[model samples]
Target: MRAGIIGLALAGAAVPVTVAAPQATTVPVPPAKAPFTFQEVMVPMRDGAKLQTVILRPTGKTGPLPILLQRTPYGVPQSAPSQVPDSYKALMKDGYIFVYQSMRGRFKSDGSFTFSTAVHPDDPKAVDEATDAYDTIDWLVKNVADNNGKVGMWGVSYPGFAAAVALADPHPALKAVSPQAAWVDYWMNDDLHRYGAMRLSYATDWLYMLQHDKAQDSTFEYDQYDTYDWFLRQTPVAKIDQDYFKGSIPMFTAMLDHSNDDAFWKKQDWLGALKKTTVPTLNVAGFWDQEDPWGSWQIYYKQEQNDPDHLNQIVAGPWNHGGWHGRGDTMGRIPIGTDSGIQFQQQIEAPFFAYWLHGKGKRPDFEARMFESGSFVWKSYKHWPPRGAVEKSLYLHVDGTVSFDRPDAGEACRSYISDPDNPVPFRPRPISPTYPIPDWRLWEFGDQRFVGGRPDVLSYKSAPLEHDLTVTGELAATLMASTSGTDSDFVVKLIDVYPDNYEQLREKPELGDYGRSLNGYQLPVAMEVRRGRFLESAEVPHALTPNKVIAWNVPLRSHDHVFKKGHRIMVQVQSSWFPVIDRNPQKFVPNIYRARPEDFVTARQRVCAGSKITLPVMAE
Candidate 1:
């Protein structure tokens, strides 16, 4: 847990889940005979609280090396790994004193822990993640022996947030940081919620895991194999705690209390803290990142605003939450043609730190390095969305076809009945827990055909492309339609449809029973949901006018992908995405969280002919 999948320690991305009873332990005992020697110490914070820190120095090396620090709410190690973990091998080869520390009120660390990264740097009395990170670096550079004064920080997910927070008020010794798959704003597009609709499974599972115990990460045990069934069986959002959690998870309760983007959620915004770029940053993201995908881009752009020194750079690949830590040659059914993970680690990440922390290599010159899927090649750009990319409209036709040209005169719209009682599953059923379920990580890349034909889903596809079409920037869907319900959730997905006669992949022993053929596979490039209530303004949400057409803008985020020749570009519009996205209830209520079971009802959803999905197409 210390050296690998450390983000899983707190956020539960790919961590192994122990189905047995949950137990509480003060400190985690690390494996014996690790390549690095482990030493535990209490690092004093500015607020007079002590944090549990573990320092791991290379076993045989003795020369002075810069400190590579990672602060996490996840538990720190009592001992080091028996060998260099895959996640650390690339960086370890460069040599450094690795340090891991449990955040305040986590494990043996003193002081209470608030799961928010919001920090107030102006007030001396305010101590948050930023302050804690600052204090920890101050203590490490001054107290920890080894003779090196420089420090660098890197982490994935929550730890990534901590890495970004350090930039608010960085320590003098801190030189570089990488906030991979980090969360900049929780209320907008991160873990808990997307727009205004809650991410039911992730929010429910992660809250129970992170807050259930201060000493260890816990997973909620389910009686049913399919979490989709398990979640649907629960009461409304307001009664979830009463029915199961029993107030054990305070974060869930707080989320329900703040159903809207009000002050409670607004206080957690960290963009203000990062108004200026202080430390050299490598903001990493994944085009297919299921958790915390939006943050890395948000951070990169925020830093670019005032970065006259150009210390900011980004690397986005076809990775899941922490997929870059593993072998990234293949993602689900698609072969990336290159080991993107290693490329990022050895070429980009390692070099960035080498230049900034150890002064060993030249600084990265490019502003963005992205892995363009479909083409399965690495792309370098001086600016993201590359200067040559242009926004083009892909219109939806009532005949169930999509085209770059405007739709001819025909039926006004296509309709579907979205029933909350039988919501559309985000993935094929027999769905397992969000964490530990190997399939959970690859769900984003799963074939959309599973739900494409459902009565609740409306699918439209363009004819086979004659040439490779590359989309390299932000994507959005402008839906001009109406709903029978006063409140609705519009889910838009940009998909890549493989040709019926697509070339089949060679059967590898590692693939086992999974299909090797890519024929007719519907891979989602980008998908997002926007609630009708918050369409106008998130702060003042009101009931929508029933049966009245209105424009709904659904942001599909950004991606660097190509629709190869003969492959069709598809767009799928739906209402509910099952437990992945909480049921909208359809009928508007003052607080959807408090809506009764009766609030759930069937609503007619439509996609008008004029509706179009704007893609940032790279100019040929």
Candidate 2:
């Protein structure tokens, strides 16, 4: 059950689940020296599905111990220390019973596992994750050997998503909850489509892994080294299943069947279901969390709506998906200026669980703890966006310069031809899968210089900043644009353009070779894409009138970063983010999944000069 089986095989590829196993070091707590024991038990649900559960307890307890639960689909952690690695010494040192369980239809558990839905409060007999959690807690508080009634939940990625939804309606004993880089909505945020653009590489590979075999752990095998080329050769989208999947992953079919964000996905919005709950929760995120960066923000915002007790708190760091658990001080080539992961784990995460479960510390101020990206500093806020934040719009000029001033009355639209045949690569030439386990995790940090100069991409940058310009909170682009094709895709990237002498002036050491020069590194802070057909309504599709200018609003996920003096704020526009996102085809099609090769055509797109991006800039 070692979570090291992270990328338990999906169809054929090894898309490892994001939970990282801790090392084998132990903290210096005397109570942790108590004898340890493990037990495998089946906890039954209201609907009679017995979940496979593992309970690790310190038999030599000095007193009553709290129950710490981790629920996952990537099999349970090993009964040995693999289940309780050295990283856990911090929490284990505090003295508590650790519980790991396999969700239904996973491993030896009794029921079917469907990744599509969360929970339906409307149904009296619904047996979703929330109910499963409720039932499990109820059973443990009564049947488990421990005496303390308090329980805490934590997980990363899918297990993280499990931890999140479980708290939608938590039991009384459920005290503190932490959902780290957990997935929320499939359509609007997280692993699949981003704002309706299909993440071809991720979804195709993940679905294949899930639907192919019921084994506990396995990895997908690809005949070629580069997936970008592999998926290209298997274009037309429909052939993915026809060629290898053979309709094996019904989830894949279900994804394409829903052309829009209809009820199928609406019911899966985990954040939308938090209106009534008031559990003291800690939502952890990574500014570079390519997988679920948008999820934690959306979850935190929705939780803030009714958090009168101020129990909901968020921690957005410079880490990647579960990066706080991976490396503490750095992400990609960017140093956090501190051992942030260690800081969060020991200072933030451990103490958080301790305060709620053991009643050892004072309640937090409920402020958002954020790692300022550009400046490489950690700043705590009484509230996110830090109060007096200003909304500034950087207008797109005909001259390709992004400025704070409006366009000067001229035909200032920037036009680019979108060719599906030669779509812009999301990464370098040989793009690998999203998970090479460790290395693939850092791809989101790849330098923007890869696609910066592409003909299909339109880039707009402002003059060098004379002072530190820090942006916090939400990011969005308002565009007046048109396309020659009836349907298209629009991608907007917000970047931080370092000074040409960036490397020379800086003294920090570089981390990895992402294949780019640091002299003038173009680092992307945030980005997103909107499928043209869904511009009107995510649940509906409409064709555009060729050459007619219309409004396209693209939401670039929120962030906290400072653009230092001499740096430039840039924006890049394109119609496709290949392989990562399927080709738009640039033509109208009710279901892009079934579109023929003929439906794929070249289209001329235009972004008028009046268009501008709104940045959430905080007043220093």
Highest TM-score against the true fold, candidate: 1
lDDT, candidate 1, equals 0.87
lDDT of each: 0.87, 0.81
* True-structure Cα RMSD, model 1: 9.9
Best by lDDT: 1
lDDT of 2 at 243: 80
What TM-score does candidate 1 reach?
A: 0.92
**lDDT (10s digit) by residue, model 1, range 172-274:** 8989999998987888999999997899999988888888888888888888888888888775876678888888888899888889999888889988878
* lDDT of candidate 1 at residue 137, scale 0 to 100: 91
Q: Which segments of candidate 1 are over 4 A away from where they belong?
A: 1-34, 409-411, 504-516
Cα shift from native, residue 323, model 1 (Å):
1.2
Candidate 1, residue 579: lDDT: 92
